[model samples]
Every structure is written in C-alpha cells, then in structure tokens.
Target: MDHYEQQALRELQQWQIRMNKKPSLFNGLTKGLQNKVNNVIPDKIHEIMTSAIKNIVRAALLGSEFTTKKEVPSGLSLAERERLVRERLRFYKKAAATEGAATGAGGLFLGLADFPLLLTLKMKFLFEVAAIYGFDIKDYRERLYILHLFQLAFSSDARRREVYQKVLNWEATILEFPSLQAIDWRRFQQEYRDYIDLVKLLQLVPVVGAFIGAYANYHLLDNLGDTAMNGYRLRFLQQITITPK
Candidate 1:
C-alpha cells in the first residue's frame, strides 16, 4: 500500500476502537438525564419530531433533490477525494452554523425551524461526501448506508457499537433487509432526538441561544464529518487487498 493509504488505514483502526468502546459511567449518567428530558417532553411533540425526521430522511433517500451536480472525476486517489470532501464539509459546517445562529436569535419559533433546516443540510452534505468517495448515491443501498453513518455518529455508545457492527458487515447486513421499510425508524428517530435534545433545548433560550446554537451545530457537523470519513475509509480499505510488508 501507498504511504497515504497506510496512514488512512491506521486512522481507521483508531476510529474503529473508539466506535467499539463500552459506555462509561459518565455516558450512562448523561443518557439517563437525556431520557428524563425526553420523558418530560409531550408525546405529541415527540411524535411530531419523529414524523419530521422520518419523512425528511425518507424523501432524501428516494429522491434526487440532494444529489450534487459535480461528478467525482475518475481515477482520483483517496487523499485527493478526501481533500474535496473536507472542503465540502467545511462549507456545510459554516452554512449550518449560520442557520443555527439566525434561527437561535429569533427565539423559540425560529429555533424550532432549525430541526428540518439542519437535517436537510446534513443529508445534503452526506450526499456530496458519498459522491466524493466514488460511491453512487443513486443506489438505495448507498443511501441506506448514509442513514447508518448518521446513526453511528449521533447515537449513544451502545447503539453506536451496534450500528458500527452493521457498517462493518454492510454487504451481508444489507441483504438481510428486503427494503428500506424494514428500518426501525422509530428507534432511529428517538436515538437521534435524545442525542441532541440537551444542546438543542438551549437554543430555544433568548440572548445566549445564538452562540450556543452556532457552536452546537458546528460541533455536530464536525463530528459527523469525521464519522463519515472513517466509515467510507472502512469500506474502501476493505475492498482492496493490502499486503503486509
């Protein structure tokens, strides 16, 4: 293997270790707190949020609305493709941060609007990233992979490990499901909502909400970008045979 690929493989290994880590005491405590917060939230609101995520994600998977016009040029190296991916990620992070700041400053009503807007931005970014990785987002399987990556990035430690294992054996796992309808979207939405609920609640407050919103959105995107890079790296490296020296 080339120097850059070797470096990428090492990084992927470290990420795998992190993905497989057991939840710590702190993780358990935070999860408990988040669950309490979710419990206090009205079931109607939870239903609304879950429905929104399901519809938006389903539309993204089944439609071409988020597809990029720029094709990944043939024969680009992994390093080259990743450079473009990073550039796109930075752009999306800035856009998300800006959206978050604007909505946050406008009080609770606008803050509520951030959910769909931010989700669209994230899904769009993933589509662009998939293209850069030379994956055909037009394929349903690839789109499903995007959802798994999203779950991996935002779910709690235990759920993250479960999703990570599916990602690791994606080729086999994909076959077990007959269609996208087989996905447990209720669990998916709940995990994602619980994951972001704490920080997102702060965005509803007056004055300081703007700063919190911007920081949270940027940080979230940054985390997702790293997860996506390593997720794709796992697939890429696994597809090619690397001889040990």
Candidate 2:
C-alpha cells in the first residue's frame, strides 16, 4: 500500500464522519441508526426519480413563468428542458397507462407540491396510469394499505422478509372498517396483493430496484458502502456469471 492510497482512504473516512455529524444528513435520525441502515435505497431512487421529475417540474414552472419571469437558467434552456420533459413523459406513459402522471417527473412534482388533496389525487393518478398499462389498482382501500407497506418496508435498511412481515402487521388496522361501513375486504385484498407485486418489482429488479434499494439505504443511514467491498463484490459476480464460449 502506498502513502497516497492510505491518505485517500483516511480522507474519505473523515469526510463520511463529517457527513454523519450533520443533522440534516439523516433528516433527524440518530447517528447510530444512520450507521445501521444508511440512506442507500431511498436516496438512489430519489436521486434518479428527482432528476427525472425535477426537469419536468422545472419545465412546467418555467412555462408558467414565461408569461411573468421569462428568463431561464443557463444549462436548462426553456426550449430544451421542455423538449426533454415531453420525451420523458411519453416514454413513461408508454411503459404503463396508469403511469401517465408518472410519465413526466415534472407533473408528479407539481402534483406533490400542490397540497395534501392534490397529493392523494396524484397518487391515484399514478395508479390509474399503471392500470392503463394493464396493471390493476382498482382497490382504493387496499391500494392505500399497500402503499403504506411500501413506504414502511423501504423506509429503512431492513431485511426484505423482515420488512414484509412488518407490513403485514398493519393488515388488522387497515381492515378494521366493518363490511357495513362499505369497505370490501375480499375484493380490495386481491387488488392490494397485486399492488404489492408492483412494489416488489421496484425493490428486486436487478439494476433498477437493487440500485434504488442501495441508494435508499445509503441516504437514510448516512453511510457509504466500502468502495473496495463493492469492487470485490462486482468482480466476484462477474467471475461467477461470465462463461467462456
């Protein structure tokens, strides 16, 4: 090991410690817990989702501002941003019909930014878009429960089966409404189970879901993976998976 390599390692460690010390980094969680989970999963998903969504939102906001504050940022020229967002919206919408609002990151942002009512509406809209692509989200009550499960399970760096059980624990509470209250459990449960499949898809898909899970855990826990560890893991996987002709 050379002096330069050792020095770089020390610097990276110190930087991580410094980041841990910052309260906003973990968004108020204790340093110990942050060390445990890390914001690896959610953070990555947020990064990609935000990058995709922000531009779309920026386009809409800019469009609205054109009549007032017409000036635009240097890199994000209004015309260019608009074009890119439109393209993204189209692609995502094509991926699944219930995904229409999910098509444009900007549109999702706008929905979230508007208010609680709008937030719920936007969620419903996302489900609708998914349905358009042949995904079922017709069970509102159960769909809500599934969403809660997703939020809780991916909300931290926990084991998959462990988190899944935790989600199931909420079933009683979610089903408390009597049949007389007009909430139908049989139908809703079926649909909710289907939505669970969607959530799992986002968590387990090799590149997309795994990266999201890693990013979410990293950001949530305020810790970075050992780069050396990551490199070794990748090499190991490649060695095992690749075969000579």
Candidate 3:
C-alpha cells in the first residue's frame, strides 16, 4: 500500500475499535431511562411515530428527490474522493444550520417542521457522499448500507455497537434480509428520536430556539459526516486489501 492508503487503514482500524466498544454505565442508564419513557407511551403513538419515520425514509430511498447529478470521475484515489466528500459535507452542514435557524425562529409548528427538512438534508448529503466514494447509489444494497450508516451515527451507544456489527458484515447480513421492509422500523425511529429529543426540544423555545437549532443542526451534521467518512473508509480499505496487486 502507498503511504496514504496505509494511513487510512490505521484510521479505519481505530474507528472499528471504537465502534465495537461496549457502552459505559452512563450510556446504559440513559438507554434504560429512554426505554422506560417509551414503554409508557401508548402503542398507537409508537405506531404513528414509527410509520412517519418509515415513510419519510422509504420515500427518500426510493424517490429521486435526493439524487445527485455529480458523478465521481473514474480512477480517483480514495483520498481525492474524500476531499470532495468533505467539501460536500461542509456545504450540507451550512444548509442544515440555515434551515434550522429559519424554522426555529418561527414557532411550534415551524420547529416541528425541522424534523423532515433536516432529515432530507441529511439523506441528500449521504447520497452525494456515496457518489463521491464511487458507490452506485442506484443499487438497493448500497442504499440499504446508507440507512445502516445513518443508524450507526444516530443510535445510542449500546445500539450503535449492534448496528456497527451489521455494517461490518453487511455483505452477509444483507443476504439474510429479503427486503427493506424487514428493518426494525420501531427501534430505528425510537433510537433516532431519543438521540436528538433533548436538543430538538430546546429548539422549540421562543427566543433561544434559533440559536439552539443552528448549533444543534451543525453539530449533528458534523457527527454524521465523521461517521460516514469512517464507514466508507472501511469499505475502501477492505477493497484495497482484497484487490489483485
């Protein structure tokens, strides 16, 4: 391997170790508390929330709304592709922050609107990142990988490890599922909602809502960008190792 590839492999190995680490006591307690809160909610409410997230995400996966026009030029190195990925990430983070500020300034209704809008921005950013890494977003498996990557980013510590395992063995894991419908939508939605609920709730406050919204969205995108780069790095480095010399 060249110097850059060797460096990337080291980084990917570190990320893998972090992904596999067990949740701390505090993380476990927080997850327990969230579970307790979820248990008290009515089944119908859970169904509604899960359905909403499922439909929105499914639509994004199947629809053209997030499709990118830019194609990765053939023969670009992983490092070059990641440079473009970082640029797109910066652009999306700014857009998400702007959208968050605008909606947060509006009121309860507008603050509520931020969920789908921010989700759209995130999904679109993932599509662009996948393209930059030379993955064919048109394939169902690739899109499924995107969804898992999203889960890995937003899930709680314990759940994150579980999702990370799936990401690590995606080729074999994907074979076990017949279709996207097999996904645990309820768990997926709950984990995501729980992860951001605190900051998002703050975004409903009148005066400080805009600032909180902007800051929250920017950091959330920043986290996602980091997770995505490492996620793709796993694939990139693996491909390099397995390819014929």
Candidate 4:
C-alpha cells in the first residue's frame, strides 16, 4: 500500500473503535428526552413527518436523478480519488451553510423548509462522494450503501452500532438487506430525528436561528464528509472473505 492509503487505513481503524462503542449516560439521557418530546407531538404530525422522510429516502435510494456526473476512471489511485472527494465536500459545506442561513432567517415556515432542502444537499453530496470513490450511484446496491453511510453519520449510539456492524461486514449483510418496503422507516426517521434534535430545535428560534443554522449546518456537513470518506476507505481497503457458493 502507498503512503496515503496507509494513513487512511489507520484513520479507519480508529473510526471503527468509535462505531463499536455502547451508548453512554449522556446518550441515554438524550434518548429519554427525545422520547418525551415524541410523546408531546401529535401522532398525526409524527406520522406525516415520518412518512415524508421515508418516501424521500426511498425515492433517493431507487433513483440516480440527482447525480449528473458519471463515475471516475477505474485507474485513479485511492489518494487521487480521496483528494477529489475532499474538494467536493468543501464545496458542498459552503452550499449547505448558505442554504441553512437563508432558511433560518425566514421564521417558522421557512425554518421547516430546511428539512427537505438540507436532506437533498446531504444526499447529493453522498452521491458525488460515491461516484468519486468509483461506485456507480445508479446501482441500487450502491445507493443502499449511501443510506447506510447516512445512518452511520446521524443515528443515535445504539442505532449507530447496529448500522456500523452492517457496513463493517457489508460483503455479507448487503445481500441480506430486505426489500425497500421492509425497512423499519419509522425507526429510521426517529433515530435520525433524535440525533439532530438539539441543534435543529435551536434552528427554529427567532433571533439566534440564522447563526445556529449556519454553524450547525457547516459542522454537520463537515462531520458527514469525514464519516463518508472513512466509510468508503474501510470498504475498499479491508480484506473481504467471500463465502463459497
């Protein structure tokens, strides 16, 4: 392995240690708070939001309409590909911060609009990163991998460990994934909801909204970018033990 690949492998090993950890006391408290908040939200609104997120994610998983660029040449080195991936991430982080600031300043209605808009930004970034890593986003399996990356970035501690295991051993689990309709989307949505609850709630407030939105988005995108880089690094650099047919 070359120097850069060796550096990446070391980073991936450290990330694996983080992903395998159990939830801490702080995590337990946060989850409890999320449950209390959920209790206060009317069932109808909760259902509507969950259904919307699920359908949007399902559509993304099945379609490549978001990506205009084709996959890179197969001959590109891992170092070269990761350099391009980092560049894309820098560009998208600016975009996300911009979008977040604009919507955040517009009061309640526009604050709510950030949900789908930011989701689109994040997904589009993931598609670009996948293509940079030479994965075809047009393939459903690749798209599913993208979703796992998303879950890994944003889920609660318990859910993060579960999703991390699937991604870590993806050569086996990827094929075992159930049909799209079978995914527990309610849980998916809730875990994602709980993860971002604190920062996102502050994003709805009046005077502080814009600042919170910009900082939150800038950093969230930054986090996702790092997680995605290491995710693909782990997948490509690790040795896979293929089962016999």
Best by lDDT: 1
What would the per-residue lDDT of candidate 4 be over residues 1-245, giving only the tens digit for each residue? 78887787778888889988999999899888888877875565465456667767877886656764655778788899998998999999999899889988987667777777778888889988988887878777787889889999999888899999888778787677665555667788887777775676678789889888889999989989988998888766753331211
RMSD of each: 1.9, 19.9, 3.0, 3.1
Q: Is candidate 2 or candidate 4 better by lDDT?
A: 4
The TM-score obtained by model 4 is: 0.91
Q: Please give, for residues 111-141, the per-residue lDDT of candidate 3 as tens digits.
A: 8788778888889899889888889888878
**Model 4: which ten-residue window has the lowest total lDDT?**
236-245
Worst 10 residues of 2 by lDDT: 223-232
The most accurate candidate by TM-score is: 1
- Give per-residue CA lDDT, model 1, range 34-119, as digits (tens): 98888886676666677779989999988889888997898888899899999999999999999999999999878888888888
Query: So what's the TM-score on candidate 2?
Result: 0.23
From the highest lDDT down, the ranking of the candidates is 1, 3, 4, 2
Q: Which candidate do you rate higher for lDDT, 3 or 4? A: 3
TM-score of each: 0.96, 0.23, 0.90, 0.91
Residue 229 error, candidate 2, Å: 29
Decreasing TM-score order of the candidates: 1, 4, 3, 2
State the local distance difference test value for candidate 1: 0.89
How does each model score on lDDT?
Answer: 0.89, 0.33, 0.84, 0.80
- lDDT by residue (1-245, candidate 2, tens digit) is 24533443455445334322423545335334434433443554334443433343223222322121223234432234334434433443333322222322233332233222222332333333222222224444434433433333232323223333433344464465333244343432333222222332244443354344333323322211122111112222233352111
Off-target runs (Cα >4 Å) in candidate 1 are 42-44, 243-245
> How close to the true structure is residue 14 of candidate 4, measured as C-alpha lDDT?
86
